[model samples]
Target: EDKVVQSPLSLVVHEGDTVTLNCSYEVTNFRSLLWYKQEKKAPTFLFMLTSSGIEKKSGRLSSILDKKELSSILNITATQTGDSAIYLCASNSGTYKYIFGTGTRLKVLA
Candidate 1:
């Protein structure tokens, strides 16, 4: 079965804390790895790592993919209250469907 799992289902950090989120997966045919931030309604794309582009970085967020290890990681530096949101990790199978992990709920205290 294809699946994605995230560690530390929830986290609480004060302002200026650097946090790391982990995501591991097992899939039949992995096409890509995606990271999303879920604050409301729907998740917004944060990063997308594929064979052509295995690393993606944006501002305070960065992510990398390891095809051999079948895992990925998301790092957030200098977290603020505005960064408090659910971080989701998903694996895109070749079939165009994504298998998503439950997500890590980050709570940044002011």
Candidate 2:
């Protein structure tokens, strides 16, 4: 069975603080690792990593995957209160199915 694990299940930080979140997985026939941020409602797509050593960035968020280690990291720099959300990591392998991590709850205080 495929499994995704996220570190630091929760986090609390002040505005302007930087944080690093992690996701690791173990699965058969791994295809890709995806990152999403859930604020209030739906989970918004952040990044999809298929190749190692490539970093995907958007504004203050960035993520990178390490295929050799079967893990990925999400970095948020100078976080604002708006950045507070539940960060989720999922691994896709099977037919249109995904194995998701428990998620990391991040709270950024102003």
Candidate 3:
């Protein structure tokens, strides 16, 4: 069965701190790795890593994929209170369906 798992289901960090979120998965015919940030309602897409060595970054957030290791990492540098949100990782099996990991809730305090 295809599945994704994330460690440290929740985290608490102060402003200006950096955090790393880990996601490991096992899937069939893996196509891509997707990252999302969820504060309220549905999650918002952050990054999609398909090719290795090429990372996707936005502001203080960045992510990279390791196809061989079957894992992905999300890094947040100098986080702010606004960065407090749930970080989710999902794997696509070259199909319309995706396997989602148990997101990590990040709390960034001022």
Tell me the tens digit of each residue's lDDT in model 2 across 1-110: 67899998999999999999999999899999999999889999999999999999999999999999999999999999999999999999978879999999999999
Which residue runs does candidate 3 get wrong by more than 4 Å?
none
> lDDT (CA) for every model shown?
0.90, 0.96, 0.93
lDDT of each residue in 4-108, candidate 1, tens digit only: 999889999999999999999998878888999999768999998986436688999988888778888899999989999999999998776899999999999
Q: After best superposition, candidate 2 residue 45: deviation in angstroms?
A: 0.4
Instruction: Compute the lDDT of residue 70 as modeled in candidate 1.
Output: 82
In the range 43-102, model 3's lDDT, one tens digit per residue, is 999999999878888989999999889889999999999999999999998758799999
Indicate the residue-level lDDT of 18 in model 2: 95
Leading candidate by lDDT:
2
**Steric clashes per prediction:** 0, 0, 0
Candidate 1 structure lDDT? 0.90
TM-score of 3: 0.96
Task: Give residue 16's error in model 3 in angstroms.
Answer: 0.2
Model 2 lowest lDDT segment of ten: 91-100
